[model samples]
Target: MQETVRVALDAMGGDNAPGELVKGAVDAVNAKENIQVILVGKEDAIKAELSKHTYPKDRIEIRSASEVITTEEAPVTAIRRKKDSSIVVAQTMVKKGEADAFVSAGSTGAILVGGQLVVGRIRGVERPPLATLIPTTKGVSLLVDSGANVDARASHMVQFAKMGSIYMEHVIGIKKPRVAIVNVGVEEEKGSALVKETFPLLKECSDIHFTGSIEAREIPHGGADVIVAEGFSGNVILKLYEGLGSALIGEIKKGMMSTFRSKMGALLVKPALKETLKTFDATEYGGAPMLGLNGLVVKTHGNASAKEVKNTIFQCVTFKEQKINEKIKACFIKKEENE
Candidate 1:
């Protein structure tokens, strides 16, 4: 198989590291013939995990990293003190251009911190935001800064919209994706000072299909293709979305089992409902990418299965092939000059 993309997988990262993490890396390599994976972590521990599988030897290799970064540790301190940790080592591989991308399921804060501080942002990028693809009624919407840039400004919101548009258009193949700033309401005067200022900025930008403001309640209906917001609001909205989905599923399951009649009906409709709900599961979307950086960094759930891990790895291929970073820089630079 011709290797087109080489990814650095943090074998020591994630709750299931060296086990699920190692298995995920091997599974990704097995599924994608053109992709190669370099596992970074304790060699012996990684070997123990790999021993359970009979993967092609050429497709996977383990790099040594004695220390492991814990999710409890502070992002800055962990990155600095745990130089030999798998997460740190993986970033090193990406920084040195030895790998095309890096994937971690351990500490999201560390990944975001390392991505900007270590991998750094592209020239002209003010602040990099973590972007995630959320499944919606109309299909999927890209949420910009879902977990980064908590203190972003209106200018930053405008930049997020533009950068997100480029990603959705070029990488996600959503031509002319409607970009909207997540606000308290659709009305121009309905938000904190930030939303009010960002509304006109996004509307004035001719490059993106600015759709004005999007309310959190309308997010599940896929109100916009690219939803832009400061990390604070975005994070709250996303967490609620995930929580609501879980709570709904639980209620439906319990309600169906309350009586024989409902149980039978549920049995008949279980397959369809399960399939439908599966699409909304956050884990199904894999990790979120930290955009505006010089290189790609994806953050997956700590309990991510091999399937989710594989998706996160494949996501990098599109980011690289589509030249998302280059296009994002161009979009902002061009938009900036117009202002």
Candidate 2:
């Protein structure tokens, strides 16, 4: 028998739980040739969802869990208490090497805490940042520490740059990614005390294509290939980017239907407009991966559809095949020695 990519999914974790989650697992299995899904949730709930469509029994299986982890629960306490919760169960599979990866749309806090506590980090990985790929005017830029690593040290930001560059190059297929530290000014002297200290470090490093600082205003113009920041700023940037893109698309849509002349113009430009705006839609890039962990872990939106979930699964295949974590450590350690 050939080795297969087995993913343990937390079926009860997402906003659309068991329904979209289970549906997504089935979709991933259907789309990928050698992938098996072990859905962790109430067996009956999974069965009910599966009954809605015909699926290959061997490809999709459900593991029963009695309790669900709500967002309200304290993450550490919840992971400790809800031993049978879908999130914990899914993480455990990765720890045991039974599954190749784990995907969750559950509590972001719980998932971040669980990934480190359960899956553990790679050797010498101090802070594993949540890295997401963002499309820029030039192309896609990998934004590191997009959710985790708040109140970061200068060292963490440095690591984020190195890891982000490795991910963009190996997994996302960007070569010589221009790594930039997000700042209020493009100059090294500008930014918070943290950014100012880290600016010089990134610039002095040879492993990454460390460009100067990138202000938020310049992100849309394809200013940088990888934007490195602490989680606080990166999260704000990520949310704003998503919001701005959605708002722009919404205005375009409403405008298209406003008048007969506008309607005809919309019809003429529909295909090109869609192709252009598709670049801005975050879902097209798949979920953000919690990089530097011992095993592959991706955090999708709580309301992710089957398409997003499916793309994330395929991303795992490439992340693993590319040996992204190993490459990151090598790049970082080499940079460290050079420093």
lDDT of 2 by residue, 116-192 (tens): 99999877678899998888877788889997989989888888888888888888898898888889987656788
Using lDDT, give the best candidate's number: 2
Q: Rate the local accuracy (lDDT) of all candidates.
A: 0.85, 0.85
Query: Candidate 1 residues 35-152, lDDT tens each?
Result: 8789998999989889999788997888899998888999999888888888888898898888889999888888888887778887778888888889898778999979688989
**RMSD for each of the candidates:** 1.7, 2.2
- Please give the lDDT score at residue 255 for candidate 1: 96
Could you tell me every candidate's TM-score relative to the true structure? 0.95, 0.92
Which regions in candidate 2 have their CA more than 4 angstroms from the true location? 1-3, 329-339
| Model 1 regions lying over 4 Å from their true place | 1-3, 333-339
